[model samples]
Target: MLQSLTGVEKHNIEKKQAKALFESTLWSDAQTIGVTISRGFEWDTKHIIESGWEQGKQMVVPKCNPEEKSMQFYRLNDFQQLETVYFGLQEPKPSATEAVSPDQIDLLLVPGLLFNTNGYRLGFGGGYYDRFLANFKGNTIMVASQQQKCESIPVEAFDRPVQYVLTEEGMKQSK
Candidate 1:
């Protein structure tokens, strides 16, 4: 299992490679999706926005309040319209961020500290996403560098499973 954070240079390279795979496979048919901001130490997701743009699909991002342990997702209809919010992550207008109704989204690209092909993941010791995903109705996919893959990740009872895992190597569905 890979531990510690990946360096910026290596992370960027892996992110680019994984993004390329994501673009070639799903971008062509996906019409709507949600991605998360690449906070420090998190996987980069700017390419999801670019891929969404190329496909003319609607892209959404999440605004999270660690204090409240809650999240609001917004459609990235226009990048210029986004404004920086808490923790330097971009969020749509107040009205743009809305509660995610189950299954309302077609896809959700997730980022995590560690994961395995079976969909098990270890987050940053926070239950925020694990809880938020309890009700999400969509195909959750994990995007991370090859180095993030682990032989096994502790599975809590409340953990949510992903539909697939995307890495620099290619795509692998959770088994």
Candidate 2:
């Protein structure tokens, strides 16, 4: 079903999703936000980052630390600084060395291929976000389509649940 949203349909849904996220108090109140660079059919977060920049919010993106089996958030001043890495995904350069502490981030925009209404998500099987969120103390929000919210998905002990989810339909609290 994920393949069904194409061309104009995908663009329109992404726009609506971005708009809904923009209108949320979560986005408005955040000073520093942790978000990922979307690839493929993932919700395009470029819109959110651009909007956040316009709003004067500090934008941060993750750089995977494979050795540690974790990810770290780095403050991104410009999208031009990101380079495609880690299995063809755009990430902040290692030279952009300023690390943003987890406590310093007011909101974290988590990404997932599939999510359950219960808040569990099926990631790229890296467990990077899971490790990061293990100690992160902030609001966790995911932008996804209603279709991605499934009835159930396999979960592990280390899996973490997001506090909220922002879909094209609207934002919903996830337990």
Candidate 3:
């Protein structure tokens, strides 16, 4: 549904959601933020990136290591430094900067196709975020549309739940 969004729909929804995120206490208090590069029909993260830059907050973007099936985050200085990687998703270039340990992140914005009330998400099947969140101690959140929130979803034991889910309407704390 996200990929099929019209220009107006994308603009209006993302604007509202990003505004809520930027105004949230989590976003304000966080010094180092971990987020993904928006690809295809995913939620537009440009607003968040630009806002972070203006706030002088450190923004980190993930670089997936397909061989190890893991992800590492590096500081994002400019969008021009990103290169398309696996699955046509943009990732931080290897020479961007040194990796920031997961524990150093203040807040993490996870990406997903859908997020349930329980905080379980249907991701792109890469398990990158799931693996990273396993040992991450920072606050985790996902920005989703109302239609993406379901009553329940199939979750495995290894699946990790985020602390919050922000939508166009408002934020929902995980149960």
Residue-level lDDT of model 1, residues 61-165, one tens digit each, is 777777888777777766675778755767667664445553566778877888887887887666767877888867777877777888767887999978788
lDDT per residue (tens digit) for residues 75-132 in model 2: 9888888999858989998685478889999999999878888888888888999989
User: Candidate 3, which segments miss by more than 4 Å at Cα?
Assistant: none
Tens-digit lDDT string for candidate 3 (1-175): 8878898998898988988898889999999999998866888887789889999999999999989989999998888889987678898888856688888899999999888888889898989899999999999999899989877788999999999999999777888
Clashes of each: 1, 0, 0
What would the TM-scores of all predictions be? 0.79, 0.95, 0.96
In candidate 1, list every pair of residues with a backbone clash: 103-137
Off by over 4 Å in 2: none
Angstrom error of the Cα, residue 36, model 2: value is: 0.4
Q: Which 10-residue window in model 2 sums to the lowest lDDT?
A: 1-10
Tell me, what's the RMSD of every candidate?
3.2, 1.2, 1.0
Judging by lDDT against the true structure, name the best candidate: 3
